[model samples]
Each structure stands twice: as structure tokens, then as C-alpha cells.
Target: MQSAEGTTAEHTAAKGRPTPKRREAENRRRGPVAPPPRTQREAIKRMRGNKQSKEERRKAAAERRERMMAGDDRYLMPRDRGPVRAHVRDIVDSRRHLMGLFMPLVLIVFATTLVQNIVVQQYATLATLVLLLTMLFEGFVLGRVVNRRVRAKYPDAKDRPLSIGWYAFTRAMQIRKLRVPRPRVTPRDAAKVG
Candidate 1:
């Protein structure tokens, strides 16, 4: 039968510190394993394969150090965030993409539905051909229109009109429809209150 103080002292001693062997064993389990010579060789080979030229790396590092020391990062002029316009070619490409995805879906549904319908079955071959041609024509027209609309607002290139493809479609679209919601005019604040 030990005194309360003695038991408390014993408990504290037990919990106070880990034995050296126990600590070493824990460390060994959690520690990184040394790689085999083969693995090391492979890793080195990979690093060499991916390695940039020493001179280029040194130059890049020097530039980075210069930037850090200069501490004028914010003072450095921001890049021009100008809009890029869409050209005719882009409209055509986007139209092609749009139609390519949609037209096939329409054709599949038409084919499946018409394959069983008596009236459609009678003209199935001709109907399919007509659908295909229609889709192509629609694609081209839509693409052309899109190109025009996109070019009208964004302009293919800021300096040159013929720079090609809308680089700023999202921004241009946002600009096209600028609307600030205004508060409703009240009778109390109306002109002459009438």
C-alpha cells in the first residue's frame, strides 16, 4: 500500500519520459528509408534528363535574386490586359464545334425515331441525307454570324483588325451588356413631387 503522494510520484515518473531504446525504435520506424543503388541511379538519370542547362539555370537564379533584392515588384509595370477579338476563322471553328456536338445528337434521335415510323421509314434514306445537309448549312451560317458578332465588339486584335480569334470573348460579352440597376424613382422625390 503506497501513499497517494508516492503513487502520484511514480505515475509522473512513468509518464515523464520515454526510454532511449523506445525513442530510437519509434524514430527508426518513422524515418525515411535509404534508396537502393539502382533506384538512386534511376533517380539521377531522370534528374539529368529533366535538368536545364547550368548556364540558363544560373542566369535564372541571378535574375530571381536581383528581383528579390530590388524589392520593386509592385513598381514593375503590369502587363497590358487588352481584349483579343474573334476572327472569321474562329467563328467557323466554334460553329463547327457546336454543330459537331449537336448535329450528331439530333441525327441519332431522328434516325432512331424514324427507323420505326412507317412514314419516315418510307423516306428514311432521303430524310437522313436532308438532315445531314441541313445541319452542315446551319453550322456554317451560325459560325459566320458568331464570328461577326464577336469581331464587332472585341476586334480580332487591338492594333490590327486581322489578328485572329476572340481572345477576350467573356470580357467582351460582359462589356456588351452593361446595366446598372437603378433605384426606383419615388413619388416623394419625383420632380415637383408630381
Candidate 2:
């Protein structure tokens, strides 16, 4: 048998010139072959007589209705029902806002403590350490508050920090201090049919 590229297996019996495989391959590579076109009226009638099963028809009709309502009829595109990323962004934004609110007050307290110190040079390293710790603490406090509020609102939210360690401890503190209720939808509500 000869390959499409004209290489032949020696075991194959050659025809009068090239193998049958080579002739078939040459015909396939030469051009595209199209089936004959059907008459539009005949095609329409045939399609009308060919009915889909009731369930399939119902599903198709429902999809068509949805597309019509959405008003983008170019294609049957999938709908995105989740707002997870937006919720995460909201948490990040709230964290940043609260950080902005409390950072200045923390800095002022640190500055005052450093200013009245008996030995300025002696406390420089301690002051630096305090400042770093304060910034980190502020970030933690604000992050916890934001995350707690978000988690309470969206209990089933994926990628949320669920552990009660470190940041989770701070979240508990924020929940306690601010009296923020961790309101969540029940599992039954989540299991409800759409």
C-alpha cells in the first residue's frame, strides 16, 4: 500500500502504475466535494414534518424564550449565575477603606509614645518594631471585619478563610466588638430548586 505522500510498503502488490491507495489519496487531496443542495421549500417542509420529542421541544422553546428575553440572539450563550468574584472584590475594598480610617490614628499614637520617650536612640528599634506590628495588626483587624461580614452574608462562598486561627480569631473579635450578626442562609434554602 502506498502512503498519501507516495511512499509505498514493499509487501503490497503494485497495480499497473501506482497502487490503488495512491490514486484514492490523490483524488481526496485535489479538491473539496460537496453534497447537492436541497430546495429551500422542500427543506422547510421536511423540517416541519420532523417533530422533536415533547421534552426536547419544551427545552428548546424555553431556551429560545430566554434568548429572546435577553435580546442577544446571535447565539445560545451560557448564563453566569454566580457573583463570587464581585463579593471578594467588595471584601478587599471594605478592608482598604477601614484600614484608611484607622491607620492615621494608630500612627498618631505611636508618634506620641516615641516623642515622650526618655531615651530616643534607645527606643528607635522598638519604635520601628511597634510601627510594623501596628500596621500588620491594622491590616488583620480590617481584613477580619470585612471577611466576617462577607462570610456571614454569603455562607456558601468558596475560597473564604473558614479556620478560627490567626485572622479567624480577629474576625471573631470584630464580630464580638462590632456586634455584627453572622446571618447566613440555611442549607435548605441552598437546596431549593431554581
The per-model lDDT (C-alpha) reads 0.43, 0.48
> What is the Å distance of residue 126 in model 2 from its true position?
2.1
Write model 1 residue lDDT over 13-96, tens digit each, in one string. Answer: 466666579778887889987565477778887667557566678888777655533333432223212222213322332221
- Estimate TM-scores for all models: 0.27, 0.28
Pairs in clash, predicted candidate 1:
85-155, 85-166, 86-166
All candidates: CA RMSD in angstroms?
28.5, 17.3
Worst 10 residues of 2 by lDDT: 176-185
Give Cα distance to truth, residue 128, candidate 2, Å: 1.3
**Candidate 2, residue 36: how far the Cα is off, in Å:** 47
Clashing pairs in 2: none
Candidate 2 per-residue lDDT, tens place, 21-102, comes to 9778888888776444388887666566555566688898887766543433243233212343333333432322333334
Candidate 2 residue 132 Cα shift, in angstroms, is: 1.8
